[model samples]
Target: MNNLNTLIADYFKDSIYLLIENAIDIHNNAINKPNDIYLSGKLMAYVEVLSLLQMQAQAFSIPLESLKLDKFEAEKDLLSSRIISKEEIIKT
Candidate 1:
């Protein structure tokens, strides 16, 4: 049981980093060319990845409130800033 918990925790930790890097790439690309046609689509993809990251954190029993940990805060901040509007999340 302990090993399983550790494995799951490690997976989530790695996933968080991957998601963060992906988000940064998208953000940078969008910023580099304001007229880029794919900016919205790439950002939308990042938002989806962030939602998965959030779900994984919850599955591991980690509270969203604790995302402020020094190791996780930078990624969390980037993810938070790209949140899809509530209306978009709720759209059918």
Candidate 2:
């Protein structure tokens, strides 16, 4: 189940990025003047879709962030210990 959720989240993220790239490359290039080209209705719709996906992904990632924080703290502790021991050896 977790793997499926991760797969879905990754897919959503990829889709959102591709949609943004397409909007910038295709629609944004259609205008001769730089400021004249605006987001078309289709682009706006894609943005809305992206927003919804982002919200869902954030919700799903809350616990993942907590897990990452725990791992980072453990790594820091290990590095701190190693550094202290090396400094002590150098001093001796």
Candidate 3:
């Protein structure tokens, strides 16, 4: 049970990381190419990711208010600095 809890906690953490990374990537790309179709596409992708993350948090019983994007991104940045790559998430 302890192992399972640890795994789930890690999974939740990774999910938040991927969401922030993707959002940042999309935002950066959109800024670099503000005149192309890529801007809208990336923006939409980021929004969709936020929606999905919210749903996942709800499913995992995490409080919605506790999982706001700003808080999640800050937490992810700290967690990311300790981790090597996003590939670790695929293990679960």
Candidate 4:
């Protein structure tokens, strides 16, 4: 039973790391191609996924301080600034 519990914890930890890595890659792509709305949308989706994952991790008593969620939030904010609103697009 103890070994099973350890495996579960390790799985969640690995998942969190994988999610963070994917998010970073998406963020970089969004930064490089600011005009690509698809990449921006993908990044936003990753942010939401990470947020939910964080909540689930908390439920599992996983330590989140080392996750660097704040950095992802900052990256999201940066991408948001580059996004043009529908109104602006219409005006142009």
Considering every candidate listed, which one attains the maximal TM-score?
Answer: 4
Candidate 3 structure quality by residue, lDDT tens digits, 23-80: 6555555655667686657666666666677667778887755443334433243223
RMSD of 3: 8.6
For 1-92, candidate 4 gives per-residue lDDT tens digits of: 99998887778656755666666667666877879988889988887787776676578775665443433443344355454232321221
- Better TM-score candidate (1, 4): 4
After best superposition, candidate 2 residue 19: deviation in angstroms?
A: 1.2
- Give the alpha carbon lDDT tens digit for every residue of 1-92 in model 2: 99998888687545544554454443334332334435345445544554454455467775423222222222232213122222221121
2 or 3, which is superior by TM-score?
Answer: 3
Shift in Å, residue 34, candidate 1: 2.1
Task: Provide the TM-score for each candidate, comma-separated.
Answer: 0.55, 0.39, 0.51, 0.62
Q: For each predicted model, how many residue pairs clash, with residues at least 3 apart or on different chains?
A: 0, 0, 0, 0
Pairs in steric clash, model 3: none
**TM-score pick, better of 1 and 3:** 1
Q: Regarding TM-score, does 3 or 4 come out ahead? A: 4
CA RMSD of all predictions: 9.2, 16.9, 8.6, 10.5
Better of 1 and 2 by lDDT: 1
lDDT (10s digit) by residue, model 1, range 1-92: 99998887678666655666666667656656667778857766776667666776679887765542223333344444354232222222
